[model samples]
Target: MIVFQQRYPVAFTIAACLVCGSAVAQSAIEHHVWQDKRKFEPYSRTAKSITGAIRLSGNPDFATPGSKMTMTFGNGKKVGLTSVGASWRQWDETDDKKATAEAFKLSRDPGHLRNGNTLCGDPQSDPAQYVVFLERSTFGDSTRLLGMAVFGSKEVPHDINSQSLCGTFSYSTD
Candidate 1:
């Protein structure tokens, strides 16, 4: 295509509109840095989400019983996080299943809360909300509490932002 838009004109117009097919409704995190800038790709949308065994928040007796979690959402759901520590930097806004992710479900659910604890009756969050520590904590209390996320506006389920978001959060005991 004209030598890739004269040698990469912004990654050839975003990879020629994602390979020029038309029907574009995709973005669970797919940025080839505009094109081959590498890293960041998780766009598998056949609407596949079925689940069980999603434990995060650590210290559940040294957490070791069918653990798994993977998550990333942007461009519409807009959230992909992982700071790697600080008990995921608590931010508990009276818990509403962590405020999003469709009331945090799929069966056996109990993982979502970035209300970032204001301590005892929590209120007053935003501790640099940008969490994405997918399925961590194999004991030793590294505390990367499963699939928690935040970046742009995590005020809580006061309304909007919850389209069953998940890249691949697996933790099945079935």
Candidate 2:
């Protein structure tokens, strides 16, 4: 899995600057950069663990049954997503079955929202969100949505950020 911080070092900095304003983002960048000159990794805590089905927003073809998506996130402040086209068939049925079962079980929980997690609804409290796009869509050459998930507090963490916030995400295309 591609670690978001390692892959896109400046992505969050730019995004933070755009959403929260240059002052806040710059301050954060400066603080983090000052702390660690090698890289700017913002620390955050796992306030909640939310899991549910997520759609690839505007890309339907990549979200189809035969397509594949693998997501991974860790202490860093971003979600790592890797997608495979529909034609590339080499998926593990066992993993899919487990993920499907978990999704079903979570669906019965009342705490979760109707559409799974409420990351999009509350971005201020938890700013660490992730959106993925297929570099090459199955139907065309342009980038397309793969999927996305969010779960983390914006407040700086006093301890090590080693916990998994949102647990695991699962869904079925059938």
**What does candidate 1's lDDT look like per residue over 99-145, in tens digits?**
11211211212122222221112123323222232232323645332
Count residue pairs with overlapping backbones in model 1.
14
Q: Give per-model TM-scores.
A: 0.17, 0.21
Q: Give the TM-score of candidate 1.
A: 0.17
Residue pairs with backbone overlap in model 2: none
Candidate 2, 85-128: lDDT as tens digits: 22222122212211100000010112334334443344444343
Model 1 residue 16 lDDT? 77
> lDDT value for candidate 2?
0.27
